[model samples]
Every structure is written in structure tokens, then in C-alpha cells.
Target chain A: MPKPERIDPTDARLLLALTEHPRATTVALAEQSGLSRNTVQARLASLDGGAKLRSFERRVDPTALGYPLTAFVTTQVTQRRLDQVAEALAAVPEVLQVHGLSGETDLLVHVVATDADDLYRVAGQILGIPGVERTNTALVMRQLVDYRLTPLLRRAAEQ
Target chain B: MPKPERIDPTDARLLLALTEHPRATTVALAEQSGLSRNTVQARLASLDGGAKLRSFERRVDPTALGYPLTAFVTTQVTQRRLDQVAEALAAVPEVLQVHGLSGETDLLVHVVATDADDLYRVAGQILGIPGVERTNTALVMRQLVDYRLTPLLRRAAEQ
Candidate 1:
């Protein structure tokens, strides 16, 4: 990962405001942040131009698309074919996120399925990948806490 | 969890188009999906009204906000105090997402930290939670694939 750019407290405040209202216009953001309209626009431009911002696709939920079952698959793979394994996993639509980790498990794969049978098929598809050796699937029974960043943003702004 | 509403191919097409261009105007989505503008607007309204859509906050990357290290902490907690444990975990800004899983580990916690020491602190905080029994941390060395939904959206459209 590239060196993360440190966001100032002012930036944090703006981000927090934006988090509250994602569709907030520049004028509204300026009003919320107590900054000039030009300042808001310029800061937003910088944030957008930098690596700080990401695409809005993550807002869409897999469950809404009919694949409600969520599972984490810890995978062991052949070291030599690691790249190929990732490539193959990418081709599987059920596979949502893959993270290489430091530990016994080589990769952590996030997948979603429509049902138990679909999950089985998705897991099988992953294991059949060229370098994938083994996988342990743990189905998510409930979401104790949904994905969130507001608290962190609050912390950042406080800092 | 509520019963997931199934999306038809037309809805999938519109969603897939939205996934590609999150800020696409209603007319643009209609053109992209070869559907009437009114139809696109109605479908989007329905999708937004239902439990299908999620907040856009997931688009904000933790790394960009000065927390570069990412780790998944599998936590075992007192079954009876699961709700309290989740509430305590939410109070800690570093704890991003937590899921109750069907496995030996009761909860999977996603967290971010500024560095190794910060990670240790975050882990310790989680372990200190009233009901949190044991926690295992797995540091993400690399992101093989980031969170995505376009492929799944395409599959839904094709279905």
C-alpha cells in the first residue's frame, strides 16, 4: 500500500459532514463545515483527485441482489500459483473480496450465495481454482455490527 | 434478517448500470439499460425504498484516513452477553464490522489501525470487552481483491 496521506482535522470535519449527507452539495457542505464555498469545492476536489476517495459501488448490497448468504473462506494455496489463484477467484461472481494475510491461511475470501446449494457450488468453484489447496467456509449467521466508519471519522475529527 | 427481495433481469440491468456509474442521471441509466426513463426512475425508487440499497460510507477507505493497517479479529464471546459485547465493540472506533458466524469463533471483527502498536492496542481493547473471551488477529498483508458487486450484478442481469 502507498503511504497514506494524513488528513487534517478540518478535512475530517468535512468528511464527517459528507458522511452524514453523501449527496450534500458544496454549498451545503460549506454551511455544515463553516467554510467558504470555494474552500469546500477546492478541498473536495483535492480529496477526489487524491487516493482518499473511492468508487460508490460499495453502497449496493449483495443481499438486495438475491445472494443473501455471506461466508468467509480461509484458503490455502500453492505459493507458486498465488497470482493465478487470485485471477481465478476474481472470475467467480460470488467471490466478493480476497485478502492475503500473514498467518497459516494464505488468503481470506469473502463470498455470497443465494442458498446453501449455491454456497456449496461457490466454495467448490473456489477450491477448483488452479492453486487453491483447501478452504474452510464459515457462514455469517448474523451481523452484530454492520460495516461502519462514522465512529472512526468522529475520532479523526476529534484528533 | 428479512426475506431478501428477488430482483428481475430488468432491475439487475439498471442496478448494474448504476454500479458502473453511481452518479448516473435517471435518463442516463435508462439509456444504458435500454429502458424508458420513467421505468428506470420507478425501479430505482423501489430499490431505494426496499432493504436493497446500503449507505455510501463503505466507499471511504480506512487507509486513506491515516489508518493503514487492516486486520480481522475472530472473537469468542460469552453467548449471553453477545449484545453487550457488540455494543462495546461499536464504541471503539477501530472496530469496523462484526459478524456472528456459524463456527467455533462467535464473532468476526474487522478493524483498522495506524500501525502494529495501534493494532495491539485495538486488539487489547476488543479483548477487554466485557464478554469478549478470546481474540485472534490476522493482519492483512495485501488486498488480492477489494470489495466488489459488479460481477454479481452482471450475473443477476444475465440470469
Candidate 2:
């Protein structure tokens, strides 16, 4: 295990800049955070070691790509095979997101299929994973707006 | 407005392959799809004209980067400011996934914040948006997995 490196306010600020535009150059990030360029690089290196950094890559709309079926499936698992089930679910291509959620369900899965028929087949595959007892699935009717990370990064900077 | 371009099964197969590995060269894709490289490049040209190929980009993870606060905010809108509320809320940087939901709430927003306090600040900002009636939020504790196109594309290819 790596030692926990402390993150100062300036390092956090620099991270905010990069989160918004992962493509932001070292010089641009330094200017944005009012830090020296080398300082920004060193801080980024520290960030890499301490906390994971998710980069800014273009996120596409599934519907736009002809995947009209989307569902949020929540599952409850039997204790014994939690990790195995979760790992197996992760390997499935349609299940975009899997999580150990807190509410009524222990696991939450976000999935995409070409149509209702395909969704059923994919859901069956998920259900087959060991330890999965029950699943509640909600179909996405239509997408209003999708993903944009700009606001998230901005709020963190303000903090 | 972009008119829809027709995509045959072969075209769909090629597109799905590209979505799976955007960096895959046409030659490699040809080997995977069992099609000539020239056929693949021509399909790319037609899709570009129709705006079917939005972009090819690397997908980045946000949590790995330190902005770990992720939430889904469902908001109800006053009749007068439905459009304005949606637009304003969309303007916020933290709210990455915004949806005009149907049932109890008018919209559902996915936000990524730096931490717990940061998520609160983002929620507050959403509450401040004009015509915003009220908001309920579900924070994402873990992102087990995320955006990938291969699975969906594979189904399209089969069709």
C-alpha cells in the first residue's frame, strides 16, 4: 500500500482545472490555478499516486449510437459470492455500471441493450451470476440530456 | 437537423468495432469484420457526412482523478419555469447527467463533486435555479463500471 500523500488547497485547485479540461496544458493549468507550471506538474504527479484521477474523454449517448434500450437494474446478493457475482457482471458488455448500492437493493446495475428482447436476454445473463437473488429493473423511456463534467469540477474548485 | 443515414449490417459491424476500440486501424478492423479495409474507410466517410459518427475518444474515469462526489438529483419544476429551470440546471458544471424524467420528478441530474460537502454545495446550486421547486438527491457511492460501446455495438452488428 502507498502512503497517503496530503493534498493542499492549491493541489485541489489544480485538479479542478484538469478535471474540466483534461486536455489543458501544464502552462494553461498553472495559469488557471495561479501556480507555476512545474508546481502544477509535480502536484499532478502527487495526485496520480494518492487519489485516482478520471480524465476528460468524450462520453457518447447510447441512444445516438442506436442502443434504444436502457435499464437500471438493482440486485440483492447472497453473502457468499458477492465479489464473484460483481466481477462476473462487470465482464458483461451491456452492464455499463455495477455498484454496491445502499437502499432496498444491495447491487445496482446500469445496462443497455438494442431492444426489449435483447434487454431480457442480457438481464437473464446478469441474473445467472451467483449470489444474485432478486433484481428490479426500470427501463429508460427517453433521454433528455446526458453527461457534462464541467459543473462538477467547478463546484469542487469553489470548495 | 441531420437526416439519418442508412447503415447496413456490415456498416453497423464496422461502427461497433470502432466504438469498441477507437484506435483500431482500418486494416485491423477489416481483419476483425472480415471486410476489405477500403470498404471500412468508405463507410466512415458516409457516416461522417450523416453525423452518425459523433467522435472517437478515450473514455476517462472521474473517481480515479479525485472528484469522487457523484449524485443523481431529481427535481420538480414549477409550470412557469420548466424550460428555463431545465436550461439553467443544465448550465451548472457539476450536474453531468441531466434528464427530463417522467414520473414524480421532472428531471434527474447526475453530478460529480469533489467530496461530500462539495455534493451539498452542488445540490444547493440546483435548488437555487429559478423555477426549481425542490430536489432529492442520490449520491453514487461507487462507480463499479462506466461508458463502453462494444456490447451495444455488437448487438447492432448482429442485426
Error of 1 at B8 (Å): 3.7
Q: What local lDDT does model 2 show for residue B81? A: 67
lDDT of 2 at B120: 88
Candidate closest to the true structure, highest DockQ: 1
Q: Fraction of native Cα contacts kept in each candidate?
A: 0.84, 0.35
lDDT of 2 by residue, A1-159 (tens): 663343445755775665455446678989988999899878877665454332211333455566667787768888677778878887898887776654534776888887889999988998888778988676665455555544444444565
Estimate, for each residue in B1-159, the C-alpha lDDT of model 1 and write its tens digit.
Answer: 755766778888987787676656789999999999999879988777676777656877788888999999999988889899989988888988999999644899999999999999999999998988888999999988877888877777887
Question: Candidate 2: where is the Cα deviation over 4 Å?
Answer: A1-61, A64-66, A74-94, A102-106, A113-142, A150-159, B1-3, B6-8, B15-21, B24-28, B31-33, B54-58, B64-66
Model 1, which residues run further than 4 Å from truth? Answer: A1-4, B1-4
> Would you list the C-alpha lDDT of every candidate in the order shown?
0.85, 0.65
